[model samples]
Target chain A: MTREEVAARVVGVTAQQFAMKTSDIKESDQFTVDLGADSLKSIELVAAYEEAFGLSVKEEEALKVQDVGGAIDFFFRLLQ
Target chain B: MKPYELQDVPTPNLLEDTFPYSLPPLIKFEGKIKETIDGKEVEFDPNEVRTRDIHITDTTFRDGQQARPPYKREHMVTLFEMMSRLGGPKGVIRQSEFFLYTKNDRDTIDACRALNLKYPEITGWIRANKGDFRLVKEMGLKETGMLTSSSDYHIFHKQKQTRKEAMQQYIEVVEAAFEAGVRPRCHLEDITRADLPGFVFPFVQKLERLSEQVPQHMKVKIRLCDTMGFGLSYPNAAEPRSIPKMIWRLRNECGVSADRLEWHGHNDFHKVHINGASSWIYGLNALNGTLFGFGERTGNPPLEGAVIEYVALKGGLNGVNLPVITEMAEYYERVIGTTLASNYPFVGKDFNTTRAGIHAGGLRKFEQIYNIFDTTALLNRPPRVAITDKSGTDGVALWVNDFLGLQGEERLTVMKVARIQRWVMDQYEKEGRMSSITDQEMEEQVKTCLPEYYQAHRKN
Candidate 1:
């Protein structure tokens, strides 16, 4: 998938996980700070992304993705 | 102060030298262990344990029976057979003493002899009386432990004999054992509370002289019994109580060989197991212990703990079947109708089970992080997580993955078990549940939440 497609999917998953609108999510918004993703929520987001993309991200590396842009970039690189 | 700096490296150093994960962590010794005995400095070579013929001797039937009701003949036979396998062919558990007083005891000894195992040579225990020599002769045993109480507390109070009378009585029994061709292991009861210079040393010297008259195989053995659990392994400790000094005086001062010396201790002060192991380091060969530390008053050193310690000191199993310890524990519970504490080391039900979420997380990532050693491979007990309010999603994930026997890529992540964790949390948070989530509850949650994996993996 392209970076734009990855970004769109990442935003969509984050919105669904936190029960927010897609327009309200931002690339600079931190998963824990700006968005209300607790430890379990962050894990849930990763699981949701894994399900949505049909890919298993390494737990340590996936948990390191801090923001929406970082998640998109991580999945995009994994996809390539 | 010497300067120190952090030598940061790219990779983590797990220090596999000691924590090899395949066995118990190796117990390495640095220089000589020193003890001040009789106003003189004495040094004992701790490294000798690596090559020494150090081993465990059992008193389960003798002292172990003293704490509880007697085990049936069949129970004794079965335990004896299991002990043979547990100690293996090399006889790490060299001898097990039994009571030869009753018809039941003789019958059990015969039944155990019927198994025809080589290790754990059955010996008899009797009072320091010439009449009891008949039982040893009748049983045709090679060795017997005869009580020769060393302390004034025992000699004066218990035996109602002066020091001279007690020594003469003990010597007569030893002579009788020699006449009967049975090796006498003098049970120096309360040696740790005795006058080492005044009585214990003199008695041991007399035993040494008696041993000189006999053949090497039939020589007198001295069991330094800490009957009151007053023995101390601490450095610079005083005589009688100091295990190091007592062994030193017996070995160096009175001329007793390491092989002929044994350390038997009680757990009145919770120093039972370490004191037994310390005896090995202090130059004794046999550590007298009962299974699960079951003995008089508090208990003797645990035979199973000594087995693990043997591996640690020797740095190898040396044919000892470690898993039989688990089997023995199961036998003690199932057949013997006894229960071991869940948190008891090595054989407990929850010895390797984790209750903390952080520990479960580490266990999920790498079991060696939370586990003491490879208990799963060694003791047939894998690291486990007991889910409660404290066990977060990580614990649920570990429990689920371990239950399904999933490994590598198939192991479930915390996200997959989040719902179960949520329900577990709600049990306490919402419903004020105060107990741990049982394995059955976790299995049901797996079936309900992660039914696909359960179907694919657990159905078998």
Candidate 2:
């Protein structure tokens, strides 16, 4: 998916998951800031990304991926 | 690699330092675990204790349909059966609480009345319209709820009526239902979302007066409907405590009762599960739910889940017959033609299933700890689990052998048995999809992971 699409998806997923307003999610907005994502949830999100997209994200490399764009880029690179 | 080696695996010290425990076979688990796979703790707040004399009537039928797969009539019957079976025979009538208020909906009400003729009392849901009351009358649905719009959105925008008009309308329709031999339970819809200071409280004040004028048996249920799933317990709501504190305040401050107060939540946000749970713990005896948690948009709290938790987990029933919930869900999903979100709470296809490495490892640890539910003082049930998620052929084979109790050879070849789920799951993660993975791809995963050295020990 495109980066913007990924961001939208992130916002959509986090909004529903966290009960936060979707508009509150911004590109620079840290997960802890806008979405109230806990440590467990952060890991769960990575698992979700893996499960949703069907790819392996090394637990080591997974931490470096931050924003929705980063996740999208990581996904595309792995895909290619 | 597993957290521990599969061979020479250290059996978990469950009861004492020396004893090893396996999962109990008699109990089927039905509660939310505060811990994640690796066993991080989650917090839960138990509300003030109150006598649970009132029964909750769930409307997943109306509110829960938006987000989920379709719920047909038979699905409704199955839910009724489950609700009854959860609480008891009396629980059946007290809990089989959904409504049909329109002539078009009479068939379902008639169906309920038919059920009631044999059993007496299947609760019904109703709109706040006068015409809706007529249908309740025709169906002879004695225990009926008549709902009227109280929120600005519903009154001004959807129903196009003024607050005063909605109140008057509520009075007119509820009175009509009472006159027609129906037990009147008025649902003040959108009470939370309503312009409360200006509209809701004043209307409620007058409703209390109207209620006093009627007989005490003429019940009025002020339904706190989070129509968009964003209710008073929401972060943006006038409060932040989800629905627990709200229900408590509504009961204590608003002068509503355990019997007359009903809480309805939507899952647009994920709080409905906690909200519904807290409402009961707080004070409201009647909590609403949908089957399979299916409903509009995100869906309602899975009624099966809430029932499971209430009876099987919190209240602790040793034999509540929850083993069939998954099977029932399978039947409903088929009729609805939508796969249950594997992650959907409780009865969802994968709720109890595990996949993550830590989770799988932990399952290998406490799969027996769940046996505690069956033996514990509070809860008792065998943990219900059937894993369809995992990674690596070894992991898959281990779980399969665990399921089949296979050991030592004579085990069916994984490669020849079917396909590779772990590799496919990994591929799915990496690429978002690998639709091209053929049956052969799965075969390779099984073959490479499982070799001739693997032996299933369970003897036929």
Candidate 3:
């Protein structure tokens, strides 16, 4: 869909994966540093996004996304 | 030192010259190996191995049985047949020696002889007694290895005879073997720790002299036994312990030809395999070994290792059948009820199994990264990923795809197997599991996560 739609869904998946409230999750938050996602958690977060968006993502490229905003941008391009 | 710069090429240089990936890495050599003996520098052409008929002889029944409970008669017969196939038509594995002490042993020899394979002509082992010649003559074995311990330790302490007495006693046995119309292979026990010039050389020279009087097939053969694993393969390593100088003296000084010479080693110092291989490069024709390095004490040089070494040196398998190594391992585990260490090279359960996530990733992209040569092609064992908490998604994907028999583009990716990977991690992370996930457990996960693929593939 749109970048805003992607960002909203990415933020929801990120919050659910980290066990944080959706309102507390920020666009600038880095997955590991700010949200406390480990390597496996980061992979789990990508899997969550794939399930929520109903689309497949390139594993290497998707895993490279560092933050909520980066995840949004990655999915936005894949969807286009 | 000369200045150097990196080429920084676009693609990786895989160095296929040494690591052809289809076979064991080739051992390329340059120039000659030189050693100082009696104030003279002697040069040995290491490259002679390529042209020489370097081969393996087995003592699995003789020395291999010494370390473990005696193998049943049927076990020996089955193993002998497998050994013949393992060494193949050219007889890379030439002769297998047996003990003639028991009726069962002689019966096993008779049974193996019935197979009538051309290579690994069944031979016998005995103490250096003229009396033992009766057993060899009775068995109809063309060649037999007789104990002729050479060191002062063996001569004075063990045999309780002076060097002259021991040498003369050994000569009498060789003469007896000739009279019996059997070739005698003199196993110079503890030669690595022996006084080579005084005892070993004089004795071998006498044996060589005696060999001249007999027909070519009946000539005496010499086995340099590093009985205590004291032999060193290093260049210029001193005296009796140096394999090169020891072999060099026997070949050049004592007038023993390479064909009639064999190197038998023990693994007391873990130098058995290398010392045996070094003897071949230093110009001996035969490496006497036992299966899986099972022999007296720390065992002998592993015959399977020697087979791989032979291929690497010759740069080809010649006539060797590599898959029989796996068969032998299975036979040892399943029939013989003995399990090799999981990490034993080439033939163990975990020999080609990778556990690291990064390694699994590399293996998924290119198998050569984590595997040594092509185990699938050579040993009938493909590279495997053992699933653990640290195995990550790549490991799960590899395991699942291998389980499902998927390949190339059809192979499931890490993302596709994310749910199974999560379950695998949760085994240790959530359930506090401490053991690796078993193949049976992984099969359950495949049936759960990818039921469609499982149903489609395993429907029959």
Candidate 4:
């Protein structure tokens, strides 16, 4: 999948997990600071991304993704 | 202040020398321990325990039975058989004393003897009466412990005899044991509360003299019974409560060898196990204890605790079968209808179970971080997580993985068990549940939430 498609999917999952709109979610928005996602929620978001993309990401590495842009880049690299 | 800096090495140092996961933590000692005895400084070499034949003797039938209802003939027989295995062929648990008074006790002894497994050679406990000598002779037992109360409290108030009179009466019983070809173990009842220089020393010296006349197998053994749990393991803690000075006086002054001396303690002050372990370091060979510390009053030093201490000091199992401890606990609960406290070390229901979220996280990452030793390999009990409101997603993952018997990369992650964790939280927050989530409830939740993993991994 293209980086645009991965970013769009990442934004869609984040918005759905936090009960926000896709328009409100930004690539630069931090998961914890801007989106109000707690530790468990961040884990849930990663799980959601794994399910949507049909890929298993290592927990330690996946949890390191801080912002929407990072999650997008992380899944893009895994998809390649 | 000493100059010190954090080296910050690339690798973490877990100090495997002290915390080897395969065995109980090693008990390393440095330098000599000195205590003032009768205005003179006496030194005790703590390192002597490494080579000494330090072992455990049991009073589970005599003292342990005193605290609880009597075990049936079958229960005693079963427990005795398990004790033989727990101690193993090396006989880390050397002898177990049984009451020879009752017909039931004698029958139980016979049943235990029928098993004929060596190690934990059976001995008898009797009152210091010349007539009791017949019981020892009749049972064909080689060694017997006789009550030789030493404290003025016991001598005057309890026994209603003067120190000299009590000592003479006890001597007659010891002489009878000698004539009957049985070695006498003088249980110095309440010695920690007795006047050491006044009565205990003189009496032990006389007994040592008497032992010299008998054959090597028939020599009198002295059991320093801290009956009131007044014994202290602290350095220079004053007599007759100081365990070090007491053992020193008996060994150095009274001429009793280390092998002939035993330490028996009570748990009134919660120092029974340590006091018994300290006696070995202070140079005694045997630590007399009861199973699970069950005895008169606050109980005796726990025999299982002493077993673990032996492994720690010896730095090896030495053929001790630790899994039998779990089996014994199960037998006690199932057959005997007894319940041990949930928090009791080694055998209790929740002994290794963690309820905290952070601890569960550490346990899931690497079990050794939260577990004491390798409980799975040693005691047949793996580290577990008890589900509660405080147990977060990590705890849920741990419970599920352990319940399903999953290992290695097959274990589920916290994210995978998040739905159950949310359910657990909802029980307390949304439903006002006050109790811990039971394993059955957790199992049902696992089936409902993680259906695929549960279906694939569940052991029928």
Most TM-score-accurate candidate: 4
Which residue pairs collide in model 4, if any?
Answer: none
Against the reference, the lDDT scores of all candidates come to 0.91, 0.55, 0.91, 0.92
**Candidate structures ordered by DockQ, highest first:** 4, 3, 1, 2
Better of 3 and 4 by DockQ: 4
Over 4 Å off, model 4: none
Model 2 over residues A51-80: C-alpha lDDT tens digits?
A: 566765665587566665566667767766
State the fnat of model 1. 0.39
The residue pairs found clashing in candidate 1 are none
Q: DockQ for each of the predicted structures, in order?
A: 0.50, 0.02, 0.51, 0.60
The top-ranked prediction according to DockQ is 4
Candidate 4 lands at a TM-score of 0.98
lDDT of 3 at B256: 87
**lDDT of predicted model 4:** 0.92
Q: Write the per-residue lDDT of candidate 3 for residues A2-80, one digit (tens) a residue.
A: 8988888988888888888999999899999998887777777888898999987778888888988888888888889
What tens digits encode model 2's per-residue C-alpha lDDT throughout B208-282? 766776676775667777666666433223442245445544554567777777777777667777777666655
Q: Which is the better candidate, 2 or 4, if ranked by lDDT?
A: 4
Model 4, B1-460: lDDT tens per residue?
9999989999999999999999988999989998987788989999899899999999999999999999999999989999999999999999999999999999988999999989799999999999988888899999899999999999999999998899999999999988888999999999999999999999999999999898888889999999889999999998889999999888888999999999999998899999999999999999999999899999999999999999999999998999999999999999999999999999999999999999998999999999999999999999899999887788888899989988888787777877787788889989999999998999999899989988988878
Query: Which is superior by lDDT, 1 or 4?
Result: 4
